[model samples]
Target: MHEMMKAIATAALLLATAMPALAAPAPVYDERPAKLADATGVRDYERRAVEIPMRDGVKLHTVILIPKGAKGAAMLLTRTPYSADELTGHGSSAHMGIAIDGYDSAPDVVAAGGYIRVIQDVRGKYGSKGGYVMNRPFVGTSLNPTKVDHSTDTWDTIDWLVKNVPESNGRVGILGISYDGFTSLAALVNPHPALKVAVPMNPMVDGWRGDDWFHNGAFREYNLTYIWEQVATHDNASHYELPEADAYTHYMRYGSVGALASAHGLDQIGFWQKIKAHPAYDSFWQEQAMDRILAKAPLKVPTMLVHSLWDQEDIYGVPAVWKAMKPADKDGMLFLTMGPWFHGQEIERADSLGPVHWDSDTGKWWRRNVLAPFLAHYLYDKPMDVATVTAFQSGENRWQKLSGWPEKASSAKLYLHADQSLGFAPSDKEAALDYVSDPANPVSFMPRPNKQVGYEGNPWPTWLTSDQRPVSGRPDVLAFTGPVLDKPVAVGGDPVVHLTASTSGTDSDWVVKLIDVYPDEVPMDQAMGGYELPVTMDIFRGRYRESLSQPKALTPNVPLKYTFALPPVNHVFLPGHRIMVQVQSSWFPLYDRNPQTFVPSIFEAKPADYVKANQKVSVGGTEGSYIDLPLVSAPPAE
Candidate 1:
């Protein structure tokens, strides 16, 4: 990879050379007709419902999809918390449906591409036996408990399928999205010999952090509608009731989210409620997070890691996991494609047909170029199709392959100068910025719809990376504004925050927001060419700064370094756009409020323990504070 940086630099310079024509007429891909619906014998693919037992005694319900009469063929496994039947609705009709035997889940799609497939329920969920725990679980106390977890169960299931199934090529690939995405990753942790390639999409890598429950540390805590409880348990994964859709409203701010929690009891968030019980990075969250004990994966075979840069959820988690692949030169074999869409919204486009425009499609691209060929090579000895790093460019509406992430661009840091400027040095001699975080009044960057509707759920992007101005007027929000740019500046990659000031009390929390300030206040209604919507915005919590493994309490007046990952993005900060970063001390119920007391758990702290603290964003010399951008230049606007 020695030539990587040079190749990237040359490519970036070439792209800059072509920026004049960079903006293309938005490329449109008409929703192509389903090829399998009309293909010969495609619908006749064999599928059977079966239950596979784990070493711990879980008889997980599954569906096996196989080409009629397939023999000794490699298997592709996809496990899901979502019913196997649900995935069929997600992909091309040919790949529709689920299976457990590792053969029937995707027999048609695999058969056309020529491989066997399997889809199964995770441990205790769906038709699978055993109790379920909401979210991926860590082993609980020693009383009677689950026989095995997602990892153990997956290993057991694959071992059995590779031997019992006739055309078993003895090799398997595990896959899924969202919940299944987590399961896909879970399977890879304690892998089976048969598990060859794994594609875990939009995986919930950070357990309770930002993956599913919390949004930038502030959770979307929709108590009534959350499905986690139903899918996670000690015996079975089934439907658990939500707090009630009526419980949430769009206009309710962080204060409201806090109130709702109080009404439900401390830590009303089921998983978080449980998390509060294990405040210090006890074994609980550790077991749920597989990234900590990653498997020895040179991956051995081809694999694709996919996620959306704007994936309202699961944003920061996947990319971090991608980079953690050990010995990239060895079994750490992996490729990544991050685009500008929320979760699986781009998989089939919400409308199912497209000259699609929601950033580049990683799903179809992978299924066609990567998945199809992978199966051929691993199962039938076919040659591989494309380069390693394939990614989607939102502004360009195109796919570009790279030797690595950020594709070759210089690493630069845009620091936070205490003088109110965002460049290298602060215009002020002052040491810090300070804001009080009264859990009763969390400074919000999210929008306010009607008081009765939820401004942040389901059909998101409505509140995503929207804007910092909503909370800009709050006394608690310390906004930092930068001068307008001379040319379009594109920022891509994770963002970090570093500081040198401490809390006045034992502990305090920090909240940061990155915003894209438009040349003019584009009203929400006119955002999408007359569609009312806010600008783009993102936030991050500060307590878990040093280590996600555990939360550390701050020492009074002690300065600390807090580096957290911001969601990835591919937005064009057009010339004249003012870029801004806001720093404060609270994001409220979305993230549990730090008690300012720096106690073991914020949840248990009383009101008197709360205290105010000063924050300092420095620049100059070694205090080297800044936001790093994966500033890779893309191909000229096509």
Candidate 2:
């Protein structure tokens, strides 16, 4: 009986081995939808995707949207590094308004005007075929030896559209926000004959000088994620995963931004390496500064530069470009539009920002009146009158049409006086205020539980408009408060800061903020009472105080003059409101901390380099500090 049972077990095992191991249970199907549902009857606009060949023999992926039954429609083009497919086809709907809604496209302007909308992915990004360079240098420049640049690609794209698109007129207008805005500005360099108008809204004109990459000489460390995600892949498939909920803590975990980037393998990225190699504002940054480039290049096309008052990303760009291009506007081809919005808020809803609210929809009004009319006039040859400068005056909550920007304003000096007082007149005696700047315990740029830099699910866009009370009370921050205004103090154009300061260490960072303090009580919004709103502010690295290209160590403990300009401000200090200025050594995570001890490169600074230093600011007398306000008279009632 035992022999028979053994024989049966052996036979069963043999059969199981010969049965292909149960056939591996057949691979599980993905089950999730592979593609979106077809939009046959629901489709409103005709969509076409094609690869337009560049002069360098690289093809760029482009998506064109022609309104149904359109005839002789003007083409509105937007060249972007962000995907063209994602920008044009965000949603499926019968109405073009719902289908095309994103960062670059304005639904109201496009659908209402019956434009042939076109969006193209720049070379080496998304569907484009070529090597990608961040802010690709001009074709003849040393950085870009290739025959292709954003300008050439734009010229080729416009040339193709004018010849190929059957439902469009020969005239083409280019417009975009942010990076796309930068591309629009690029098109103005040797613009195509068909490209009649260009609008660069909140564009990044310079990366190193008070733009995306750095503010003055201080590195904008928060942009590390942007470089990581953008340059890691051609399609931007990689995303940055935050290690902690609080960005401040996450950044502080590593001694320096360079150390943090190295841990994340960002040293492999070309741009990251370039940033490390070029710590100072050398030829690398100077050659690519669009403001400087366009100043020499011909300005043939009618261009409109849009600036957001509280633009956190590119606050210095539009103003810098506008100032550079102003002298070249011999044909009266340049225009400026300043809005009371955050970065790219003009393309979105701009009725309110943070604690401030406009009674009407400011975005809608600007789009319908200023933007649309300007495009129509140039693209369709429509009879529409637009001003050279359309500025949105904050506090007053009204739009002003001026003959030109900076509007012939008078100058007034707001002196930092003794006893933490700010007045129009200087104090009789010299007074100095002292504060301790500890790099280990740096001041936070915003409130705690801080989110990473992004538009969605983050306070990055509106953080500039947030209340400043949190940092004003810190011991390291010195606040100078002026008396409440009995009458309105109107300010236009830029506010310049002339600071006489000294630091115990060899290297330091100076942060100056011009704030508008609301009244103690408010009838409209109780929450807004006593709110401290930063009107214009900036940071300067002391190492580059004398020369941007050359870094020099400071004469420690000696008072030195540090003069810099805050961003342009068009604000009204209403009756009962106070004007305040806050000075600090660090605006952490927003800008990397300065190692008090001088180092060849702050990026390579060791942990020991970070030391606490005593900082002093001269208030009055021979070596006094003050802010130069561009004072203008109040506009007439509408």
Q: Which candidate should be chosen as best, given lDDT against the real structure?
A: 2
lDDT by residue (tens digit), candidate 2, 312-411 = 9999899999999998788999999999999999988989998799777899999999899999999888987789999999989889999898998999
Pick the TM-score winner.
Answer: 2
lDDT values for all models: 0.57, 0.91
Worst 10 residues of 1 by lDDT: 528-537
Error of 1 at 305 (Å): 1.7
Give the distance in Å from residue 509's predicted Cα in candidate 2 to where it truly belongs: 0.3
Give per-model TM-scores: 0.73, 0.94
